[model samples]
Target: MVGMEADGKMGVHLDVSTPGYAGRLEVVEGPTGRRVRSASEKARIAAESLMPGAQVSAIARKHGATRWQIYDWRLRLRLGELVLPESQEPLFAPLLVEEAPLPRVTPKPPKSAPAKVEIAINGMVIRTTVEVEQLAQVIRAVRASR
Candidate 1:
């Protein structure tokens, strides 16, 4: 129950009856093996963890990062930010779009029967309609009449 500590330090040794001895349970801040992570550095590490066949869990653990951080980095890459070195074994390519040449669909002319033939009988004029395919037959029949 001593004076207030500005560092907001707290701890828990078997001693709560001590004054100003904030205890040993407080956060230990030092430069021993602790890494001072920069936002960009973390982002880069996280991004790498999401690469194809990468050991995300191992990378995260090594960097003292949560898997969710790596997952978040993947999402951000999708939205555009981080990028892998190469795409030889890529899961997917980034967004690609093309206008498709405005759909050069020159509408074709509607097809129609190439030709037609008509045969008449006397003045009564009974007409027998025939497809263009029979034109040769009609010519032969007329020639035989001569």
Candidate 2:
């Protein structure tokens, strides 16, 4: 009989009266061999890992793979080493372009009157809108005349 022992180990127990009976049995633990996956299957799993909001660790666990394997597969896909089937190609909605509205035009305000400056030097008043440099020359000429 094959059964689990009290310590949680699996073992085979046989009756001593059985014919050709073995006195002992050997128990092996863990996986006896590595699992092999096909290229297409790996590609599919790799593509799924690239989906938005898809968790790499969860995808790896679901497909009996490690996170590193998923990442490697993604890299291979990017490098063109792995090709996705035609049906797996991404689809996009048609883009529609519409004409934008013209911007509104605003009327500019009326130009303000030019400011007038009056200078009084030696009781001789001079009123002009000339620039400061020209006014400085005039002031020098006026002072030199006095």
Candidate 3:
């Protein structure tokens, strides 16, 4: 059997029975070997770290892992490298689809008619519709006479 103490040290208790021999108790130091965590176990641990008020240090200790390892697993899960187990399927809101209302089309008002201009050149009065082509000529004549 294997057991871990409060100080975070793991030790194994070995009992051997023989024809005429007494069992011996020996305490080994350090870890016997490296432990490989399965994918599902890693997912569970990573998810546990995300729970409300969950402490990374506590989780790491409970699972014999480091805080950085848990953080890395979370990053991998976000990047899609790790996926949740079958029992922990992802939940999502239903997608809603509806045709958007047609954009409003407002007809522009008719442009206002140009104003009728009256110009007095010296004592002579010139009354004519202000045409773009003749306005320049009228202005030139008035300036030359002045």
Candidate 4:
């Protein structure tokens, strides 16, 4: 604020407090800007976030990180880019399968009745219990005799 201009003019004054002027500009360093986190550190934070009932936002605040960062780390862990400590390998719940009861047996279909044929010709009635082909032959003979 005290330096003179290169051309020997009076020192310039910045009128920053004009109408509709916002507050002075400030550089807010976000999580990515403030520091660099190593893979191991990120893995640790991600593991902590996975604990029962652990909230990602709370974990991020505890480690001075953003929720997105923790989420990214979790994704990396899922993709195998990040590995958990040997003592903390993932655990799967035990499977307990029981034998299911046998399904109900459907009753066998009722036996079908044998086919019977009856023929009437010229006041004579013929009743026979035989296959369709035999019946047809008998009917042809009777017609020929007539």
Error of 2 at 104 (Å): 6.8
Q: Which candidate is the best by lDDT?
A: 4
Deviating ranges (above 4 Å) for candidate 2: 1-33, 89-146
Per-residue lDDT of model 2, residues 27-126, tens digit only? 9998866768776677888889887788999999998889999999989888888877776655233579998988888865555554466778777888
lDDT of 4 by residue, 76-102 (tens): 988889876678656434679999999
> Which model scores highest in TM-score?
2
- How do the residues 40-86 of candidate 1 rate in per-residue lDDT, one tens digit apiece? 56657766676678898888898887787778876776776765455
Each model's TM-score, in the order given?
0.33, 0.42, 0.39, 0.40
Q: 74, model 2: CA deviation in Å?
A: 0.8
lDDT against the true structure, each candidate: 0.64, 0.74, 0.74, 0.76
Clashes of each: 2, 0, 0, 0
By lDDT, the better pick of 3 and 4 is 4
Instruction: List residue ranges in candidate 3 displaced over 4 A.
Output: 1-31, 89-146
Relative to the unseen true structure, what is the C-alpha lDDT of residue 76 in candidate 2, on a scale of 0 to 100?
A: 88
Q: What would the TM-score be for candidate 2 when compared with the true structure?
A: 0.42
